[model samples]
Target chain A: MTFQLIVFYSFAAWLIFSALMVITSKNSVKAALFLVLTFASAAAIWLLLEAEFLALSLIVVYVGAVMVLLLFVVMMLDIDYAALRQGFVNKLPIAIVTSLAFFGLLYYFITHGEFGPQNYANPAPKGADYSNIKELGRILYTDYFIAFETAAVILLVAIIAAIALTFRGRKHRKAQVISKQLEANKKNRLKIVSMEASIEETENSGEQEPSTAEEKS
Target chain B: MTSSVNFSIISAEIFLLVALCVIMIVDLFQRDKERKLTFLLTQLSLVSLFVMGAQDLGLERQVGYSEHWIKDQFSTVLKLAIYLGTFVALLYARPFIRERNLMRGEYYLLTLFSVLGMMIMVSANSLLVVYLGLELLSLSLYALVALQRDSNIASESAVKYFVMGGLASGFLLYGISLVYGMTGTIIISEIASYLSANQANLMIQFGLVFIVVGIAFKFGAAPFHMWLPDIYHGSPSSITAYISSVPKIAAFGMAFRILESSFGEADIHWTPMIMICAMLSIVLGNIVALVQTNLKRMLSYSAIAHIGYFLLGLSIGNDEAYSASMFYIIVYALMTIAGFGIIIFMSSENKDYQQISDLRGMGRFHPWYALMFTLIMVSMAGIPPFIGFWPKLEIFRLLIADGQVLAAVVAIAFSVIGLVYYLKVVKEMFFVDCEDSPKVSNSRSLKIALSINCMLLLVFGLMPDSIYQYCISAFASLN
Candidate 1:
């Protein structure tokens, strides 16, 4: 029990420290990395609470997909960091006050509120045969089916939105028209000569047959 | 609370989803010249959705899909409004898009998807479902706002919208998490019952505050309204027509669903914050609009003020007040669509006529169009004998009924100030004249559509009893 408490406290401390670093980091990329660390620590805490599904998802989804996306955006956009920092001093007092108030309230609740070991006893350990993913799947497919489908639809919309934003059509650019090329038929490319054989013009001009026919006519 | 999910209850959503996919596929084969076919298909889908929603009306409200989805008369009304509003907006968008060479299939497809998102939002019963729907809607909107890719302003607006929208959604998710932790439920109805059975906690109140901030941002209420004006001005006016009207109705539905349904018992905790936002929006929206020359930006501010009035009704927190707010949003949407529709009609080719001076001498040349514009402006100004007057009157009536005399007076005073800018639009059309006569678009269909839209405002103004009653009944059936 003491060991468990030590692990929980350590993870919680790490989570808070990384979260603070996520905000206070000077570089945007560093901030994003710190955010990932914060998420990882939070997942560790969730695992300790027996929320295996949430812990795995917190690592897989946030650290895997969302953080990567954030990193891409941060790298893509050339942000003027100097301009961002310029207002920090001017806004410092209000920011500090608001954040302190928020922290104080949170601390008060955690320390004084009716939230303690009595309300949140350690969850029973699962049997060796137990599977958290299977439980999640069961609930998701049955009770939360609509929610799951809605989430899928949101993902689809995000994909569509990304494509729409990035897709550019340049009409003037030179590209192979394979379909148009393949659609050229014999009637369009070749015509049968129904006139008499203009042998003299053919020998002298070695020119196109259509031109020879027109000249002969 | 049933374990088995009923598929028939959400038939409209299913149909919409299938139709959107089919439209996207069909649009792939259509060339630029044949884009009208895509437009017609989209419109047909919208009309069918409206019919489906209409047929579902007056049915018993049912919660299905393990209570994460709901089908109620209130959602039905809001969904129907969204469908009808989109239909009108797309009809107005057609000529403008064609002239600007923006008749891409993606536009229609994205719009249909966004509408689907809105429908989901209106019917969502769980906070998670609500977040998903809101994200879908906003993601599509961010792309739509940046559709004019070459324009720097459009790109800038899209970026701003994305960042602000992301921040708001974060706040909302945090609030949802806190609420879930407090009550051990994510379903709105269950949350309501839970809160009613217990005393409100500080954690829940904090969650409610964040939720209120998120809602205010979505509604473009003051202090959180920085994104609204720029987005309105930067987007193509066709998209502006959609963004300015349909989404507001959807937002109101979302607010009602979350606040009145889930947090109804905790109203006292959230009311003061909402009241402050309402007051600030009204005071700032009208006062800032007075100095704007860009017609779209002015209307954007006017939208903020209108939300202020809508929030006024919400703050009162009664059946009468909820209905009044509903009626106001519907009325406001109608007037706004017509207002932006005229702007769309005036735009020829890529040259958008959105400035106040663009309407100069238009009254002399196109008397009928000008008259339509006049009616819309007067309605927006909250003048008598127009539809806008009724909703405002209803709000004020409810305010007075609830013994909020100070709120009523303050709202009335701001609205009077709002009248000056609305009249300025009319004055630009009539009193001012330019030497060069701007050519009026000869699209008879758009003219006819705008005329009908404007006439409905006046007609409904004259006979608001039925509509008002409909609204009252819709809210009365809410759990």
Candidate 2:
């Protein structure tokens, strides 16, 4: 009946509905749109859970970046929704059974579980001046320094990997072979010749060559 | 800032990182002339790292960086193996990469980065550190697999490896989060304490399943090994050699840290799942490998079977078995490097030597190369008086000693099934004849390195006690 409870229920409903729509929607684009909706609702739920930093990251990382990528891929591929859905009906029964069983298990655990108030109590609400990002950064840089550095290394590796995998050199472009340059020497690259000239033969040959060039011209 | 960071504990890693950056910059400026320099620098860095790691071989355990990492006798032993394995792999790969014009700076740089990742993983004492190190290694490997951009198969394999690797990472991260949730800590020592106190937690059991799945995928055990063959076959043999050696040692390090240290208390629960996976992997890896004509793919399957054998040690769930597993993985890494080294040495620019048929008349034409390959294959087949026999024998010895008779029997049976393919390689080398004889590697260094590598296998086979005692002492230090 309270406002927070109402907000939670509505967001929870929208999250579930959008998630189901993401899978069941016949159109791929629509499914992507529904996935966006699902992510947004999940972020809102995370907000309700007082994980403000996580909520914002979900929106920024998942919705802003990843969803756009998914949309681009879906639009570009021109995938046939009909073909994709061909076996859906045949696989539906087992899917339904598995999901229903999962749901039952979840429900049982949630309602009748050993995890209670003692193990997990509601965290105290933060003050208006508290900054989740600041607190997170403080712990991350200090206590978890190695983990932070490892993450940086992982991201660097990822960037290098992406470049290595996709970037092929263009052909027919003038490229330098440094080894060749390093190996080059005057003896190999150029020749200087000195010879005693046979003046009469040189003159006759030069004259014949010019006359042939003139005839061709 | 809880404790002052011990810079010396990670000195080798620091040295490698600095060398990596320096090489990258040098390569960038030198442009066309940087290939050989980069290769030399990478080798230099690895040698220095080996020296650095060797210096601390008998040092007392040092836990630093907020206990997220540790350097002990165990880690030092494994780090030396990684460095040595990688050095040999790169040495053998030089001729192959040079012939194929795949000698780019990125090839060597990415490998160094992955080596750094492996070092980190080997020393990790926290789940968070383990995950990050794994990601670093996986990302680098994905790139290395696709270094041959002109080949569509390489690109396809890269994509497949990336996606599957991402999925395995997700599984691993989820499991870590679950374990964190249950234990309220991420440190391995703390997690072990918590697990001992709360052994009945179903959530911990769930987390263990996911962790095992991730480990299985990394080890390329059955049911999670779909990407292994395709990646191995599609990758250039040079990259294949590097990957097949260093990564297995790193994975063993990770298994030791995560499973043996963090979740040791819940062995009864995890042992059964691991046993089933081991059995399936052995049966599947051997039987399927029997039909593979592509040498690389056959080796990948054999690698999987070896993984199953490695897991046999873990299945026994004791300290001796753990050490046996460590010894097994180290020996396996060496065997794979030598096997792939021959393949690289035989391959030329135009002829890839990808098929068993390509190896025809190798023995007749080049008896020395054939002799080396024969030693490698015989060792892999687990015949007596070879390095491979000792590890298998060690596994069986530990299993039978632990009263795991059925598991030992099944393992021995599968190993026999596995020997057929290794023998196939030998037979192809010795018996079969082809009209065209391929050119062998002209690099003297590669030939010499390979001879030493294979010779070590025999020498180690004869003197297994020294290394076996080293493994035992390292494990003993763990307690």
Candidate 3:
């Protein structure tokens, strides 16, 4: 009846439709795209619920960053879409049974007894400056501070560990050993000789005298 | 803005943040040339955290930051256990990390961060705090599971964990919002008070069920435990040890805070649900674990069963049950750490030592390590004269006291079933012989740390009264 209710229902319906499509779509890429739609519509619902920060984050993080990456990866991979669908017939019975059971349970839960509609006395106006982002930030920095830090540390560790694990050393090849290189010295390669020149001159003079005597004979 | 800051309430966070920054700096400048220095710094930080947690042991329950968080004896004890457990895990991880050339600043930093998250989860007094802590733990784990990036198995496990973990978080947040809408409050204590005054509200009950499902999933209870085996088997053995031991303590702490602190008034609704989950987890965990060939995967399922036992204590929904659960978590953590430590010791860079056959001839080749591992396995199986026995005894005693004989019997039967799989590990270690012996090598530090860890299990098994008394006092404060 109200404009707000109309908008809410529209987004909610779209969300449900998209989610269903995500499950039922035969093509993997179509299913992924449907999931993106579901995420967007859910963000709209979050906005209606006055969780603006969460709604924006859902769009920015899930749809913008994560989904885009997923789309790229999915597109790049050489997957057999038809092969995946082959099991659909075999799984149909189980799927239908599960859906029916879930629906029945949900119906029982909702209709078996009346959960009195919660009424707050003098409820605040729908948009009475409720900034979810600000409150979330405050809560996170104060009460949930330890958890926030821990998350950062965990991420850091994962990054480091990933790099370390991947950075394998080259397997046993005959590369020059550092110890062998360091052990090499000038004494091992070169020898300074002072008597070598005098011995060479004496050998040359004896050779010349022998040749001269031979020629005179 | 300044009024929002509560130094005492956020002291644990501050300590961890400072420690993380200091470790980061030390890691950057300290150079890998002096690896011992980095190790010393890490150990020092962890020990100081343990001491800080110990100091808060006798403190009265105090709410800070507008009742968004509370610190009490139960949290303090659990935090102490987690810190100590993580410290021991880190000590065990060090040798393995070095051997695999995986030693880096991030590993220690991430571990410290994960511990910090556990501390927050233990002390959380609000759903928002709970979610924050849970996400912190979950995100860290996603990365930690994928820490060994070169291993395809690790990457696959990480992807599975990430997807499932995101879904679980979404469930938790939605449940929180639903409860918030029904109660008009996000603070857990307020929600409990509101629910007490307004019982039989179907919406509130529905929200509570969703929350419990989320919690159960986080604990890797049945029907939501698909990720545990893959993650455990895929991660490095040391990380698996860390994952199996420390997070369970955090999970228990979270369950206590949510089930008891917030939903105490909704006992009629939640208790039955928890009982069903507990029974399911026990039956499913034990039955499925019987067929697992991978040691890590088997241990993962066994951990699920242990959670069921812990839940049995929780489902009793009394002070005695709470203490019993706490006791169970502590002992379970120790036994799991010791068991996984042996695996880490046996694992090499190329080999994971995850399969039962990998441990064959361990008794003949490395008799002492095998003996210690056997002791750990027997204790894990809940055999007598080990620390694991006390938690089981406590849980059964509480169950009997609470007049739940059938559930207690079920728990005991599952415990026996659990022992079968654990004994398979022992069987492989001792009875089975290998034609080619695989040598087991460990550093002196690792040997010393593991000796202390296993020795403490025996010591505590013999003398559980001291810890039991402490748990009693903690629960008394809770009441």
Candidate 4:
């Protein structure tokens, strides 16, 4: 029990530290990395709570995929850190005050209210063969189907919204009509010139050679 | 209160989902730039939804899908109202969107999707469902606001809306989390039962505070309303017309469901915060509206004021007040749609008439439209003989009946104070003189739609009880 307690306290502390770093890091890439650490520690905490499914999904989805993409984007972008921090000092007081108030309230409740191990006992441990995914799926599909479907629709809206807002069709694009291209029989596209074999035309052949090469490439 | 699985309770929702998918695909194959086919299909679906909801109004109130979705008269009435409001809004917005070159297939699709979102919200029986529905609605509106990509103002407003909406969602999720922790449940009816059995805890109180703040933010009650006027003014007038009217009703539904259905037994802790938001919205909305020159912006403030009245009714914490608030929101939605429809009518393809002064000589130039506009403005001002007056009177009467006479009188005085701005628009349309009139939209369909909308104010005003009873009956059956 003491060993488990030590492990939990360490992971919990690490989670809080990394979460703070995620917000306070100066470099974007560093912040993104800190976020990954934050998620990892959170997953550890969830595992300690016996929510193995949530812990695994959190690692697989957020840290493995989302954080990697975030890191790539953060590393690639040319962000102006100074400009981003221009109003940080001015806003710090209120931000600090608001967060402090929230923390104080949360802390008070954790200590004085209907929280802690005295009022709320730990959840019972499951059997070794328990399937977290199966249990989750049973309740999620049967009980929360409406919420699940609504969430699916929200994702659909996001897709529609992204495409609708960004997809401006090219109005003036010049392109070959495939039908017209397919209909070409060399009857109209190609014409034989009988009087073009002059000295000047032959001298201009060098420039045309590169143009034809460009088209071939 | 978990029940056997019954998908049939959500027959209307299922139909809407299938119809929207069909609409989305049908929109892709449509060749017309105006998307006439998609528009017709969308309206037809809404009408059918209205019918379905009306039929459901007589059915037994049941919490289906394991208490995750509800089918009750309250949700039914709200859904029917949403359907009717969207139908009118889309019709009125057609010319406006067409003229602005925003007749994309996605426009209709997103609006319908948002309607689905609202339908879900009005009937949501769980916090999870509420959050999902709210996100769907918010996401669609953000995209719709930013539909005009070329307009910098629209993009700005969309970002503002997205950020504020994200914050509001964050607050709500936090509150829901805390509530779940305290009560060990997320279902609405179950939460009420749990809350009634449990003692008041600081965590739950904090959670309820966060939830109330989130609701007030969604409702655009002041202190959380800094984002409203800008978003309304920045969105294309048609988008503005649609967003301003319909979502308020759905937000009311979601709030009522959560606060009353889930936290009704614990209203004592939340009502004070609601009353504060109500008072702040009233004072701030009215005084600020009086100074606004932009008519769209002014109407946005007026919307804020109307929100105050409804929130006041809500804070009263009684069935009668709830019904009155419901009636007020329905009336408010109808009037605002017509009011913005006038803005749509006055502006031509090349120009937008948004300034209050732009209505100069409208009465002289277009007598018929001007008359309808007058009725709309008069009704909005709560003048007797118009529909808006009855709802406000009902709210005020209920407030007095509940022994909050001072607040009722104060609310009435401010609404009367709100009269100055509504009448200002009226005076601009009539009293001001001009040599020539600006070219207005000549869409006969819009004209017909606006005429119908304005006539409703008079029709319902002369006999407010016709609609009031439906609202009364809706709350009569609420648990």
Candidate 5:
């Protein structure tokens, strides 16, 4: 194979393997990290397709932002996936059948259907000076404005969901409770008490006191 | 470039977004435990939105923003209904949240966002908009389910919903990618036109399967409905009520928008699948629900069965049946909300009354509320002279008329089976006696809201054509 061909096939293989691991890995953190690998390899594939902007975004957005958020959720929720999977064997047959059927359908389409290379012809090689990001941005701002705004709203919703679900405000956070702070007075905020000392500490204090008295004399 | 961006048409959405932000800022400054101002502001905006949606109804169907946003009778009517439902839900939610010390402003904010998302879904003209709207709605719902953070059950339920919802979304996104790859377009109207003209290829068929799965999952139809009961049982009752009611309309709208837009001509493929889900959901939801003692869990299974009925109406592939399904969802929201509201009502600061046994001697102690509860449960059971009966009647009639005789018979049978549990609750409330006197909710506003909600069922059941005609006219362009 040519160099580019070798690179693509290798990345594609990596993409598939990692994607499989994403589901099969029992540890959620491992699955999440495998998801990052999946995204990275997918982005590499996108770069091979000469879509530079998409590759970078796939890295910056999905791998960086979305995966980080997902990791946080996995850490925060602490769901018992093991307990959730208590009846795995009983469900395995049906799940396997469903997945295999889907796979078979996809296989049929990939091998024998009209959704083929002829229907989606590859683009001509672009000049090195070309910028798809600029082109994509033009349409994104002008034509797909509504979809863009809706996406922005969805992001806003994600933020609200995160804050609303987990933020405990003053309870768990070190946030100052203004009312409690304001209500604090000298007696409540500070405590001063006279106490009898233990034997050693008392004797040490007495000696120190006598020395200080001698010094005063 | 700006020719198609009709700002006034989507001004309602813009208004809501701006109002939501304003409320957020205002709430940030508030120290009030009840969040009274936030609630008032949210209700006021929802009222304004209801009026706006009403004004927009019956207008000529308008497409704007490069045909990405649509304003038509189909959307406007549903939007109005959603607005009204959310208004009542929040009013009922107030005391419930207050009692539990969960009365943060974020509850109203998330709910408002969810409302905004539903409105977007109804009016969305493109697949991208539909996906985004679905995400906004679902994310808010998941958060709201988990809002009572101190409860272990609530948090676990939220986790379950989040996972299932994410899987459903993934299925939908995969389907969307396949549809786009096959059709070379993401505009829903263009996709519809194309699919109507050409035979679907193998990939399109595969994609439609995923789409249907996603739709069924969102509707909580059987086999894909693993998450509904646990969530309903585990979440705060007020949140359970909210999720059960307003979002059903949005789900109906999303399914219709996607299915009708993507596969109306290829109905032969998807129809059988939906019919199967309907029967499965009906049988499973009813049978499993029969054993539930907790009213919330029982109502959740009932919700699943109701989804089956709604799906049955929708499967007929005609304007009349579509409207019938629309009416079913709207009425289901009403009946279900009132059903859950009674449970919310039963709770005071100390106790949450959710068991069927909790209703023991309620009729003996509080006759007026017991009558209201009876009406709600009976309506949910599809009894006559209640709003719930009309939708079921319409679905069965339309199913038979559509020549699906066996499906119709199966649905009617399961609906009868579903009635037993509701009647069981009614029996517990009226006949079964408890040694201790019942402690009904003392919220005046909640009782008033619940009364109005339950009464509308009987009033509209007497003359359902008032709502039925609106549903019919909303789909006037379908033929």
Candidate 6:
């Protein structure tokens, strides 16, 4: 029991530290990375509480997908890190005071509330399956089935509606029709007119050019 | 098995689903040019739903699988009000959708689905049912807000709505899990009974707080209401009309279910929390609305203030208080519909008159519509001779009767603060002058509908006894 308390407190302290780092870090990328750590620690706490499914999904979905996307977007943006740092000094006093007051209230609430160590301990097992994933699926499918289906349908309609709104005809541009290209074969391309040059016309052109050249000379 | 599944309990939801399917099939086969037919069918479905709800007046029944659905007068009254609000909003939405060339069928389908959600929510007897209903309403709203696909603001609003909604749902689900863990039950009545027997559980108290947070967020209470103004501003005027009215009724229903049914035994824990939320929402919602330039955003803030009033009733936690909240939601929904309907009428396809300045000289060009809007605004301000007055008066009376004198005082103060913003819209409509005068052209059907909606507010305001009596009886039956 002592060991478990030690582990839980360590994880909680790590979470709070990383969360604070996420806000106060000078570098944006570092801040995002710290946020990922904070999420990981929180998930660990969830795991400690026997919510394995939620903890794993949180790590995989939020940490893996969402944070990665956020990192990429943040990296792509043209942000002035120095300018961001300049505002910190001006804002630090108020930020510190507010956060301290917030943490103080939160601490008071947690410590003074009825949820003390005695209440936090797990109760005796009731010998029933309370697996998070299993119960979630059962409730979702049986009781909340209508709503689940409605959400799916709403998303489907949103997808189709978005596609329809964006797709438009390009009517004004002159483009090669695929059907016309398909109809044209090697025979149409190879058909060329062969012209024979007339000798008398060629001689007259040559003589007129020479006379003009002599006059100029 | 089939005999156990009582059809009457879920008749309203089943009827709405059937109507939605018919609307969808009609829209699918019909051509785009036949938009008017789609609108007609949508209006017909909503009206029929309203009629079905009205048919069960004062009738007490329980239905659905394992009696997890209820069809008492309370549910019927709420469902009736929601259907009426949806019907009016759809009528107002038609011209806007037609002018924008948006997909009419899908819009109507989503609206129908949202109304169905509200019905399920109000009638829900189980936590699972309540969650399902809330999600249905929320998901439909997300898509509805983004219906104007080409608009960046609409897409952003949809995203904001999605994130906030997702967070609120998480809070609600966590709370549900906690409560389930403590009581081993999800049915509201069962949980209430369990908590009544085992009121010493700390887990139950924590769970109740989390659940109330989720409910407070839905009601647009302060500190959790950052999404409300952005969504109201970003969505189209017609969609805003829908968002500001019916969903609030659903929120009230959910609050009633959670506080009165599930956590009534733990009133010592919840009442004080609700009191805090009520005070903050009232103060913040009113004060923030005072400086708003956009009418929709201002109204959104005003909605938060009104929610504070509703919460006052819930905090009182009495039979009269419950009925007063019910009456308040009905009147609030009507007044909001009338207000947004006027905005819809004035808004043209080429221009959106969302800015308060755009409403300048509107009283001169459209005197009757302007008068109707003024009546709604006044009612919204809680003035007498309007429906809004009765709800406030009833709530205050119930609060005072419950010995919550201080809460009653705070509510009255917030009502005055709310009046300042509502009067701002009125001032813009009547007094402001513009070089280019506003000209509103409405279809004959819409004109008649708007007039009727406004006149009912006045009529109900004068003779609120019947509705008030009905709500009181409904609460009595529940207890």
**lDDT of every model, 2 decimals:** 0.88, 0.87, 0.81, 0.90, 0.89, 0.81
lDDT of 5 by residue, B1-479 (tens): 78997998899999999999999999999988778999999999999999887888689888888888888889888998899899999999998998886899989999999998999999898888999999989989998998888889989999999999999999999999998888888788989899988888877888999999998989899989889999888899999999988998998999998998668888888888998898889899999899999889899999999998899987898888999999999999988889899999999787888889989988888888889999988888898988899999999999999898998888888888888998998899888868887777788999899889889989999999989888999898544
State the displacement of the C-alpha of residue B181, model 5, in Å, after optimal TM-score superposition.
1.7
Off by over 4 Å in 3: A1-217, B1-4, B433-436
Q: How well does candidate 6 match the true structure, expressed as C-alpha RMSD?
A: 11.5
Please say which candidate is ahead in lDDT: 3 or 5. Answer: 5
- Candidate 4: deviation at residue B155, Å? 1.2
Query: Of models 3 and 5, which has the larger TM-score?
Result: 5
Q: What is the TM-score of chain B alone in each candidate?
A: 0.98, 0.97, 0.96, 0.98, 0.99, 0.96
Clashes of each: 0, 0, 0, 0, 0, 0
Please give the TM-score for the first chain of candidate 2: 0.74
Q: Please rank every candidate by lDDT, starting with the best.
A: 4, 5, 1, 2, 3, 6
Q: DockQ for every model, please.
A: 0.36, 0.46, 0.15, 0.45, 0.51, 0.10
Two-chain complex of model 3, DockQ on C-alpha atoms against the true structure = 0.15
**What TM-score does model 1 score on chain A?**
0.63
Lowest summed lDDT over 10 consecutive residues: which window, candidate 4 chain B?
B1-10
Candidate whose TM-score is highest = 4
Q: What TM-score, over all chains together, does every model reach? A: 0.84, 0.85, 0.76, 0.87, 0.83, 0.73
Off by over 4 Å in 5: A1-48, A58-112, A127-129, A171-217
- lDDT (Cα, tens digit) per residue for candidate 3, span B315-419: 999998888888888888888998889878777766667787788998888888788888888888888898889888889998989899998898898889888
Runs in model 2 with CA error above 4 Å? A1-50, A55-107, A114-118, A170-217, B432-436
Candidate 2 lDDT by residue in tens digits, A78-107 = 888889788898999999999999999877
Could you tell me the lDDT of residue B414 within candidate 6?
Answer: 79
| Winner of 1 and 6 under TM-score | 1
| Window of ten residues with lowest summed lDDT in model 6 chain B | B1-10
**Candidate rank order under TM-score:** 4, 2, 1, 5, 3, 6
lDDT of 1 by residue, A1-217 (tens): 6987999999999999999888778999999999999999999998887789899999999999999999999999999766787888789899999999999987876766665445676668988788888998888898888778878887887777777777776778898767669979999899987998666655646657779799999
lDDT at position B162, candidate 3: 86
Give the clashing residue pairs of candidate 3, or none: none
